[model samples]
Target: MKKWKRSARLVDMTRQLLDQPHRLISLSAFADRYQAAKSSISEDLAIIHETFREEGTGLLETVSGAAGGVRYLPIANRENATKLSRQLCAQLENPDRILPGGYLYLSDLLGDDRLVREIGRIWATVFSGRGADVVVTVETKGIPLAYATASHLGLPVAIVRRDSRITEGSVVTINTVSGSSKRLGSLSLARRSFPEGARVLIVDDFMKAGGTVQGMIDLMGEFRAEVIGIGIMAESQVDERLVENTVSLATVTDVDVKNRKIAVELGNLFTQGGFFDGTNPD
Candidate 1:
């Protein structure tokens, strides 16, 4: 193999780190791959680290010792997060998005790859230090968001199914009420999806009265898993929410179907101190 020059090596290294966020890569491996000294690799990493921080892209953490390595953490600073939230809010405020029964259409936004990935990055940044072992979401619409977030966190995604599937083998099921519709529903999870006492981060496409999210929380209890955090792409403004302490990227403040009007704003994520301010208390 041809020895890679410093410039080429830096580009390749940056790609590797960004491609696999929250994963540790040893300097020795890079040194061997590039046919360069460990000191040279360290310098290359330092440059990448500085660029990532200055650009608000993310952070590189160094682990020292015999088993030491560099880990890339994908986090967007407060300014970038706020900018993204505002942009999404603008997109969501279209009058055409107003649906019947005071719901807003979001399938297009959730289906967009670029938008979903960015939202995933935001959620990952907010919950990075929560010691999450897996990202959990209900089947269907929330699956993409869950997988995107799990990719950034280097964790597996565990999906809760509305109905039990035979392929999933033994499963645990729970019953809960929908806060908006006030209808009883059941959610199930595979027994082997995660280990007992796992710390889970729940991600969902939308939250209306927080019923679905609250159901997921109840399902987690059946497995003896801990709910570390909950992230929603969008939430509706309601007089009362079934669940509390959730991070949302955007809020649907109003949806006047009769008048064909809609309103959107940045959610509690901005008003909430820790995540919005780019400081995580864990």
Candidate 2:
């Protein structure tokens, strides 16, 4: 590749970093790609790093040594996370979101790519240091959230199915009770989806009583996999929670169907002190 101007190089470098999050790009590789000296590549990275910090885009961690390089971690600061959470809460407060079964309508929100990406960034931030090998989520509604999170973490997504599928090959199925209805249900995961004892980060669209999340945890145990972290988009108030230590972006404090009123608030992720500190409760 021909040598490019600093301005052009900066643009290209930023684009590359943004395109591949959580990937380590050696300075030597960048130098060779742009046909520039290591010193020049380092200078370019410094500028990009400062800009990322100022804009709260995320952190660019530089590793030194022979195998050293730079890794991008997609994280949202507390202020930005709180702002996004509040906006989502306000949107969710709409009475039209109330479904017949006392469930909140979140399909529209999940369908929005931009919103899902932002939420994914938040989830990535919360579990950045978990050393998660894969992101897992149950089939259907949570698949998008799981994939979005996986994109930022640079990890593969392992989807659990509600029923066994022939295409998935050998599977492991587990029985669990539905939190909302208390009905017995089964979830299955393909045996080839992940290796044994893999560290997994679990993500879900919503949590009423954590029954589904608990089921996923149980399923992970079958493979001897570690549940490094769990993230929930929204969790509703429940008298008894089947799971604990979950990080949630928003909380549904109250849902009054007859009065058409819904109370939503920033979740424990905001109130919890260790979220921005990189200390996961899980």
Candidate 3:
């Protein structure tokens, strides 16, 4: 690497940290890259950490000892999370999003890169300390949300398909009943996509009675994987859920198809732990 000014070094360092997410970079690596002293690198890290905290973006976690350094932990403070929840609530309340079966359209919002990324940050933040080895989701719509969360958590994603495809190679299959309609369906996962006895974090686009989520959990058991956490973008209000112990961003309360109305509110984001202090949001 060529010699760089402190300003240039800081910018590059920040980029490297963001790009790598949970991968730790030794202080010496940064120091050698910019031909700066170890002390100088430490100072730069402090400055970056302060900025990250103030913006409610993430945190720079430092490790001590000769083999230790720092890694970026993607997280959203309470203030940032509240803003995102409100935005989601407003967008979801649109009556035009209602479909024939009273289902709300989510493709547009999920396609919004900015919104999806922010939601992923929250998922990653909320599930950070759970020690999940991989992010798992059923195919189709849940793929993007799984990848988004995986990116922030620095883990690989395993996709589950509604049907086994030759393209998926050897696979394990499971049969499940739809919690909403009581319809029967099958889900399959590539045998090699996930390792046996791995810790899993399940992510999904939406949930009604959690039949799909339950199916995934049952599948995980087949692989001997322990599911550590579950994150859902939204969940429909139901009298009884097939699954529980989930963190959802929003709840779809009422969808009056006749009146073309939708009611949505923020879901259990704050009740869980690891969020920044709410007294004085950043």
Which TM-score value belongs to model 3?
0.96
**lDDT tens digits, residue span 147-253, model 2:** 99999999999999999999999999999999878989999999999999999999999999898999999999998999999999999989999999899988999
Roughly what TM-score does model 1 have, to 2 decimal places?
0.95
Candidate 1 lDDT for residue 88: 93
Model 1: per-residue Cα lDDT over 2-117, one tens digit each: 87988999999999999999998998989989999999999989999999998987989999999999999988788888888899999998888866676677789888988888
Q: Model 1 lDDT vs. the true structure?
A: 0.89
Model 1 bad stretches (over 4 Å): 272-274, 277-282
Order the candidates by TM-score, highest first — what do you get?
2, 3, 1
C-alpha local distance difference test of each model? 0.89, 0.90, 0.90
Q: For model 1, what is the error of residue 233's alpha carbon versus the real structure, in angstroms, after optimal superposition?
A: 1.0
TM-score of each: 0.95, 0.96, 0.96
C-alpha RMSD by candidate, in order? 1.9, 2.4, 1.9
**C-alpha lDDT (0 to 100) for residue 183 of candidate 2:** 89
Per model, how many backbone clashes are there?
Answer: 0, 0, 0
lDDT of 3 by residue, 47-143 (tens): 9999998898999999999999999999888888888988898999999899999988999998988898998999988899889999999988888
List pairs with backbone clashes in candidate 1.
none
Backbone clashes counted, model 2: 0
lDDT of 2 at 153: 92
